[model samples]
Target: MKNINKNRLFIASCLALITTAMTFAIRARLETVFGPEGIGLTLEQIGYAFAPAFFGFTIAMIIGGPLVDLLGIKKITWMAFLTHAVGIVLTLLADSMTSLFIATLFIGIGNGFVEAALNPMVASMYPEQKTKMLNRFHVWFPGGIVIGAILGWLIMDVLGLSWQVMVGALFIPLVIYGVLFFGQKIPVTERVQLGISNQKMFSSVLKPLFLFMVACMFLTAASELGTTQRIESLLKESVAKPLLVLAFINGIMALGRLFAGQVVHKLSPSGMLLYSAIFTFIGLWLLTVTSGGMTFVAAAVFAVGVTFFWPTMLGFVAEYLPETGALGLSIMGGAGMFSVSIVLPVMGNLMDNASAAEALRTMSILPAILIVAFFGLHMYMKKRQKTFEV
Candidate 1:
């Protein structure tokens, strides 16, 4: 800890994550550009195109997880950098559904590599504060969304500038993180530090609790990202700008994540997850009923609900299932992203054939399920805590 510049590594990771996040926001914005008004792709088509971003993410994480140990985070980080560069350039050239799909696939892989390396890196860097520091590191996810959403609104919606400029905004953080990480000393994963065998690490993920969390990851991610990714389509009829609403929601998420340590102390990760599911259920329901100026109010609740979902889910595994190691974390994240790939096309079809309210109502079922799963998790953890204390 004394020799390593963990803070610099942490900052580089956050910037890397921010660069990853802006892609999400920008991709959301691009849905309109390729929709009925601009390039004339259907919502379903756009959804299919975007599907690669998640599934591609799934593939990268699944493969990159093992590679992180074999190849090292520095190599993985450069992989992310290269893919992101390619993805961005391809996005600029994208004109059809196929082009967008291929571009998004690269971007998704880039995003996956970023998480593959960074999640465990952050955990290893701050062993005592895995959950807390993870939440903090993830703050930039929404923070970058806030930055990207606002930029999209200002550049495309307000200034009437070219969308290319907005897409190019990715390069700024891209180069900065590259510079920050250059020549810095990196740490081995916690599993390596503990001398855990690769075989044991692989087997640990099969634990019932770890598998349960992976199942829950599907719903939690679908509830949060599945909705946010389609904000423009979901809220197209609203008076408020959908991207702005997206920005607002992520703004609250960033702030909440920034202060997550206190919440972690009081609620514990499982408890935090249970309450998050309950809030998400209410928030999604509110989004279905609310309209116009009231949409922001609904969004705020949704923000608070989803704020802890991603990081807390990852943190819970990293903390409780330490033996599962990077592969466990990657599987959890991969499941979440893979679920979003399934839900996106479904949600788009719903929005295409039915009303946004109907789509939202359907999406709400995910969190509703999470509420029950997380409650069981909460009680299970409480009982485990008692046993450990004894």
Candidate 2:
């Protein structure tokens, strides 16, 4: 404990998350830049181009998760830095759909590495406050999106700067986090420190409850990311400044996550997931019918719903299923991203053949599924707690 710099490590982790979140904002803006109106690529093509971001994340998390133990978190973290640097430069140079796809792939891998490394890192560092601290740590995800969205608006929309400038903004956080992590003493993961063998970790992930959560991860991630990733296209005709709306939604999310401790205490992780699904379903359906100023209200509800979804899901695994270790967290994260990767193209096709409103309604179905799943989870957990009590 004397050697561990919890404050510095937590700050560095937040910086890494901010870097990851900026990519989402930049990619959202890029949708318009490379869309049929701009570069003449169809929405489906843009979806394909963006596919790498999620799947690449899946690959990195799956690969890096196991490696975090063998290679060490420090090594995996630096790996993320290297990949993010390469991805940013490639994105700046990308013009065609093929080039964009490759660049996004690299960024997605980098983003995956960030989560693969940092989520476990934070969980390890704060064992007593896993859910609360992880939620605080995740504030940067939406917080960074808010920064990136505003920067994109100011640089491209208000100031008329090149999109390249917006891409360049990623370098600032990238450099800061690198400096913070350098020469710092990194800790072994909680699993390794507790002497949990690799076999135990792997087997834990195969358990019925763990597998169930992974299944739900797919739907939860798609409901949140699939919708937000295509916010520009979905809200194009319905809103004035979609990016601002994106910013507004993430802004609320950032604030909500910052104070997640109170909520997690009251609702429990399973309860939170159940409630999030409820709000998300309502929000998505509302967006289908709303326009103009009312769009922000609907987005607000959606943001509140998804605010706890990602980090809370990870936190639940880290807390209740601690035996699954880094690999478990990685598999959960990888599953979510992989699902988004699949849904992105389908959503793009929906946009092409149907309306954006129709796409929103379709995305709503994901959370609708989660509602039933999480309700089952809540009941299962309650019954298990009762068994333990007896």
Candidate 3:
């Protein structure tokens, strides 16, 4: 804590995440611009273009995770700033599929670096409050989406401004975070402070439990991100304002995550995951059957289910499996994004050939799997707790 500016660093991390979330909102808006009725690209093609965003995130996290210890968090933070700057400008220039894909690649890598560096940074700064603080740090993700969604509604819907103007707005946060992080001293990760070797960290993540969580990360991420990413297409026929619905879902998520400390304390991480899975299953099923204003109600339930998912999953590894360190966190994040990358095109294909409701029904299956997996995880944790208590 000595000589470290935790507040400044945390604010910078939030800004970085805001930039990431804005991309989600802006990309959701752009789906219409590049869709079959606009530039004549198929839904599947749009999915392919967007795939780089997630896969690039996977690549950057996998690379940045181990390097966070070697190259330092500040270096990764600056890397994110530079890449986001480049990605924003590139997105503004893009009008075709190839250009959009390349732009998203930089943005995705930047997003990954943000998570890779900051997740561990938050954990290091507030070791005792890893789950609570991490949830607070991640609040910006959904919060930013809300901001971006409103901006899109005003700028494009009301003001009738060009999408390029919306893309240019990202520079505001990009500059603010860059300035905040500049010349700030970042502390070493908690793993390094505890003297955990890199090899031990790697081996810890190879354990059956860690691997099991990694697999679950795939399903959970797909259940949340894949659904949100395709919101425009999924609900276009069912709702009048899909972007508003996106904002509604993320708004609920932001509020839920802000109060995550209460939920995490009450349920514990395993219990939280179990309940999230159940609620997510119910919410997705409801979405397929509901329309109009009722869509918002269903989205609220879905948001609550996914609210604690990303942060709590990371928090669990940080608290319960601290030995796995930055690499472990990065791997979980990377696996999640990679799974979303794989599913985006599949969902897009389903949208092309089948109804959006059918696509939604298929997505519900992800949370259903999570419900079963987290149920097992919950029981296993309870048994382990009793053994420890005895």
Relative to the true structure, how large is the alpha-carbon lDDT of every model? 0.94, 0.94, 0.93
Clashes of 3: 0
As for candidate 3, its clashing pairs are none
Candidate 2 segments whose C-alpha is farther than 4 A from its true place: none
The C-alpha local distance difference test score for the whole of candidate 2 amounts to: 0.94
Per-residue CA lDDT of model 2 for 1-390, tens digit only, reads: 569798998999999999999999989998999998888899999999999999999999999999999999999999999999999999999999999999999999999999999899999988999999999999999999999999999999999999999999999999999999999999889999899998898889999989999999999999999998999999999998899999999999999999999998898899999999999999999999999999999999999999999989999999899999999999999999999999999999999999898888889888989999999999988998899999
Query: In candidate 3, what are the lDDT values of residues 1-390, reduced to their tens digit?
Result: 689988889998999999999998999999999899888789999999999989999999999999999998999989998898999989998889999999999999999999999999999999999999999999999999999988988999999999888888899889999999988999999999999998899899989999999999999999999999999999998899899999999999998889888987888899999999999999999999999889998999999899988998999889889999999999999999999999999999999999899999999999999999999999999999999999
How many steric clashes does model 1 contain? Answer: 0
lDDT of 2 at 148: 90
CA lDDT, candidate 3, residue 346: 98
Cα TM-score per model: 0.99, 0.99, 0.99
lDDT minimum window of 10 residues, candidate 2: 1-10
